[model samples]
Target: MSTDLQWLLLRKYNSYMVKGLPEGPIFSKEPGNLVNIHSHKYSGLSNSKTIDVSDENGVIQITTRKTASPHTIASTRSTSNIRARSGGRRALRVASAPAKQGYRPDLRRATLARVSALLAAQKEPKAQPAKKPRGKKTKASA
Candidate 1:
């Protein structure tokens, strides 16, 4: 069976099933929470922008802005050759491609929320079984 649902957490730490991409905020009932959504980029270039969303009583607010970097705008544009462009796209197929035309922050937030919830739900399993007694020593009594 497939583990790491939505790559939220490793199967060892995850137990419950969370939606791969929930239709609404993961914690729709909870209010005033924000999620960050960024484009998927491979290679030297990083995501150019981000979309942040806040939820208040199921009301979702969105904000989008370019990433702040010390580099000038002239240096930030895509300078990679066509082959490089194709290669980067080929990589990280699971990741969403950079929002070409536009990005819907609300939808992105919904998607991110699902992953976030799953990750948050992930809990560490206790190595020692409290209900059971301590294990015998490694060397068996002769």
Candidate 2:
């Protein structure tokens, strides 16, 4: 079967399931061979799975499975480290609390009052005590 026809069949049947293209050329002169490729995104891990596509009796079959190679493990570990460093999970959890409680008019009023107070303080100058003359004060003419 032509690669174009294979691609069309794959698209028609498995477009939602499989996103990225086959690792190498699809069909590549062989009609009944398995082509493996990594997807662009899967389970929050990028390029983490090896997808197998085979033409079985003109039916395009796609299978996606995770590979247990040293590189894949190391990449997963680095991804976890990045997430920890970014504090994404913590920020999401912390932000969700306020959203769940809904808007609190009391809190909003209090925050606005504090902010306006700060702004007013910044706009108004503080009164400075009068300074005495700095010139040397010798004994005044007797």
Candidate 3:
């Protein structure tokens, strides 16, 4: 008999690379106004359109705020769609590099489980007050 799966249907990319090979002449054939990502881009300083140039630089820096590249603006928002847990909380576990592609029912389930656990953990415990003295009244009450 075929089994059923209680799973979240999410669209995800087989691979997600935050920073690609850098955006300029591969090696600066001639260093002059080459477009390159700023050093701080990795530190979350990337505003919609923030730019920084080095004192010893020769490059053009266009950020997401501007149209550095059409692909940058049209990029997928986040990895949230990959709810199937192709890799849930990478830092939580250690493993080899992930595959390029191919459906992975196993990872999908794990991801689903991780998310479910997180949601479950967020639930507040039923308000539990301390039990009061029973079977005897305090002298102060009397």
lDDT (CA) per prediction = 0.32, 0.32, 0.27
**Worst lDDT 10-window in candidate 3:** 1-10
- List model 2 lDDT by residue over 20-138, tens digit each: 46664222212211222222211112232322223233232333333366667544321111122334344233323322445222233322332233334334377999775554543
Count of clashes in candidate 2 = 0
In model 1, what lDDT does residue 9 have? 35
What lDDT score goes with residue 83 in model 1? 22
Lowest-sum lDDT 10-residue window in model 1? 36-45
Best by lDDT: 2
Pairs of residues clashing in candidate 3? 34-59, 48-65, 49-65, 85-111
lDDT of 3 by residue, 1-142 (tens): 1111111111111111133466642221111111321222211122222222112122111111232454666562222122223343541222111211222222333333433444344445899897766555555556
Better of 2 and 3 by lDDT: 2
Which 10-residue window of candidate 2 scores lowest in summed lDDT?
76-85
Candidate 1 stretches greater than 4 Å from native: 1-47, 67-100, 103-142
How does candidate 3 fare on TM-score? 0.27
lDDT of candidate 1 at residue 104, scale 0 to 100:
33
Regions of candidate 2 where Cα sits further than 4 Å from its true position: 1-102, 124-129, 132-142
Clashes of each: 0, 0, 4
Candidate 1 per-residue lDDT, tens place, 1-142, comes to: 2212423333223233233465742211111123222112210112234333333333333334443466665544331112212332332221122333354333443434533443333334559754643457434432
